[model samples]
Target: MPTGTPLAASRSTTERHDMTPSDPGARRAGADTTLVRHLNRRTVLTTLRSHPDITLSTLGSLTGLSRATLSAVLEELTERGLLEEHAPATGGSGRPARRYAFRATAGYVLGLHFTPNQVRAVVTDLEGQVVARERTEVPPSVPAPERLARARALAETATSQAGPVWSVGVATTGVVGPEGRVLRSSQIAGWTGLDLVGTVRGWYGRDAVAGNDGTLAALGEKWQGAARYADDVALILSGRPSGQGIVLGGRAHHGRSGAAAELGRLLQDQTWNAAAVLDEAGRTAQDVFRAASEGEEEASRLAAHLAHHTARAASVLVSVLDPQLVVIAGELTVGGRPFLEAVRLQLETMCINVPAVVLSELGDDAVPLGAARLALDALEEKEYALEG
Candidate 1:
């Protein structure tokens, strides 16, 4: 598995198919050529996305398509600028075969992570590279209109810098519906029912998808950060407004109403005041972490307080899911080694079987990066419907 390979399934599926008449979905009598051509287009596109350096003979052998079919599909894709044909290497004994590569920068996507405390935006190419980014802090008491205004500005600025975006992805607090609707949000004050999809869709005039911050952050970690190899993972998002992200069998679990990983409510009434713990003594979580890192006893105590509160919530999730790994992400990561150690200690005491506790390699940027992954998925056939 390369650092940014498309995914394991993409490669495995191609290996089993040899696109001949015997294939299950192969065209038959009275079949539509337009539909078949579109199907072929999608198949070639997906194969190259995962195996960009494939040669003609290898592609033919893997796809089970004849040379003439591949040539036609390749020509159509090349004309659209989604693929490129490289000059064949001269080292081979016979006539060298040309290589094919996916044009990762052919288009860009905008990924936004909006919360009551801050708004972050990023522009990623087709290959999930962050070419541009913008982030701003917001007061906890700010009204929804003010919060949205600030986020919209950041989105516009980042999009312009990264060129035209093909689609949009939004990450926010609360129970988000598939259409980008905010069904419920206690953290955002008055931001519920804002219809994020419609608003952001209008902003970029492009297709968009929205999801819970915790869920997306979890996905961001699985896709590009820690938990890449773990089949099941629990991500504890520690900050002023803490949440959770769950991954089961290598996919994000959103529950019945997108509240699967929202453990904030359970801890709010009993365990600890997350706001009081993360923001205290007029110091931000980052400042407290720096002070603790410098050996300040008071700051160290506060860091433990945060870990204790987070670990309690984590213990509950671990008992049920019993994931292979537990990841700590968000501003809490600024606390460094000591903070994570404290969380692991708490978990060890509470649960008979504690998973490996690790810090999110993507850190605070995890949410936005995951949002980019959402937009990238929309470009694939699985996420969209073909039109005649």
Candidate 2:
């Protein structure tokens, strides 16, 4: 899959008629239509989001729904303020069908990134476009509790700027346990066994979730950027100690203990910090990549070594997950073809039978966008929960 095609946009909405219709004594087609309505509405919205300005007939064809059913779905979505209709098409020889689009203000999501050096926040509308963003440096030595406090404060501030945010999501490094505890992450200071979701809930009094940075980046990319059409994607995040986020069947696979894909620590020898070697003198991942670009032989060598290790790790994951595509992002990919080509070469050599690999499209904002998507999803879940 190319990095530009979004997965949600390419989703097939054709109804499956595998189950034969029951007798009139059974549940009515009204019930089935209700399910179909919900499903088709989502499909319509997803399609409009990707295409931005599209016709209703086109939507009907894409969703494989009858024009009547598409009309009903669009009406329901529009009534709920989730979508909007534009003027009927004109000027062409034939009559123009009215176009439909997802309303940018239908809902809001908050994406927050807590890095060791900075706290980055973004607010996105339903279409995943950034509406508000803030980035500020923090003391890397701050205690975990203090850092969380600061992060929460920044989140609230960003939310205020975005106005009427529906939910909040956090992305960080380390292990986000199934129990919602962050265990043994080296991306941020004092972030071990931290109850991230609980902390956000307590602080903001709203729905929230936390995930590993690499995982979140992969999610964001899969949702709106590159690798969108892929059912299985491996995001190899190279920087200080490389890591990976694996998406299988459209959802991130965090594993049993939330430590599923830690690509950084996949070492040939147990005595090395892959991140440290890449970021000599304890520089940020960006600095190391920059050094390599400046023709620093050591930096170039370290970058190559990192790519080699990353490919080896990816091979291990491919052997198990058999991902459809691999996305190489973070500081290293910005090294342009040098880093991406090297990594691809290594992956070909390491896992000759694996899936295609590509560079990320969202750049450094992938994780933050993933966080925002998480926040929106949480908000929707809460709405359903309340209704139930």
Q: In model 2, where is the ten-residue run with the lowest total lDDT?
A: 1-10
CA RMSD for every model? Answer: 6.5, 7.7
Local accuracy of candidate 1 as per-residue lDDT tens digits, 1-388:
2122221112211222346756656543214554565677677777888898889888888888889999987875665556788988887698888999887766788889987778999898888888998999988689887888888898888887876678888999889986678999877768788888898888867788889888888888988899888989999887755788888887677788778977766666643555566544667888887888888999878777878887987898899999999999877787778888999999999999999999999977788988888777766633223332
Error of 2 at 328 (Å): 1.6
Candidate 2 residue lDDT tens string, 235-254: 87766335689888887777
TM for every model, in the order presented, reads: 0.84, 0.74
lDDT of each: 0.79, 0.72
Task: Pick the TM-score winner.
Answer: 1
What's model 2's TM-score?
A: 0.74
